[model samples]
Target: MELSNINWMLGAACLLAGIGLGVLGYHLMNAGARNAQMLRQRLAERDRQLAELRDGVGEHFERLGSLAAALNKEVGEATSRLAVEAPHRPDLAAATATMPEPEEAATTSDDVAAPRDYADGNRGTLSEDFGLKQADGDAPQPPRY
Candidate 1:
């Protein structure tokens, strides 16, 4: 009878241990599942944000392309108008009509020398007239209030 009681006590202890282990295992599995769900949700949100950013960038590039094309068309129209109107100016008409073709003009040295005098003369006069000073020079005294 003593041996039987000892065996029964050991069996009860083992059963209690097994039940505690099972509860612990169940709680661990539940926590892991919750963590996995949270990770999946985060990944989904990130993917959505990336998709939105990609779409926005695509739209921005498309708008830039459209604006560039519009600018090009306007520039072309303006160039045509200038070409048409340039000959109508009385002062410019004679000069334009008498001007040699580009191929003929390229063979002459006159075009290259035309602006030499203009560029050489009064190069520094504008800055002097404007009273502009270089930063390396002595600082001008501040005006008294």
Candidate 2:
């Protein structure tokens, strides 16, 4: 009878230990599952924020492109209006005539004073002065070094 009671006590202790271990293991597994779920929620929220940022950037770029196009169109229209308004001015008429688009007038050399002809008549001597002065049909050289 004494041996049987000892055996029963040992069996009860083992059963209690097994039940405690099972409860502890179940709580640990539940905690791990909750942590994984929280991680997944955080990742989803981050993805949503990234998408919103991308959309905002795209909208900003679109607005910038539209603004650039508007500015270019306004500049073109203003230039056209100015050309139409001042059609008879010598410079304006010259610009419109498109005859080899006359090479830019040469800068005056420092050695020569402003021409007397330019003073009397508002037009500067462009090709005529150089043509008369050239020796043997060579291009005229600037007077100053």
Task: Give the candidate number with the greatest lDDT.
Answer: 1
The residue ranges of model 2 lying beyond 4 angstroms of the native Cα positions read 1-16, 87-145
lDDT of 1 at 4: 94
Error of 1 at 108 (Å): 26
Report model 1's TM-score to 2 decimal places.
Answer: 0.48
Give the worst 10-residue stretch by lDDT in candidate 2. Answer: 101-110
Off by over 4 Å in 1: 1-20, 87-145
| lDDT at 56, model 1 | 100
> Model 2, residue 125: what's the lDDT?
57
- What does candidate 2 score in Cα RMSD to the true structure? 15.8
Per-residue alpha-carbon lDDT of candidate 2 for residues 7-111, written as tens digits (9 for 90 to 100): 999999999999999999999999999999999999999999999999999999999999999999999999999988976646866677775533444343545
Model 1 clash tally, residue pairs = 0
TM values, all candidates: 0.48, 0.48
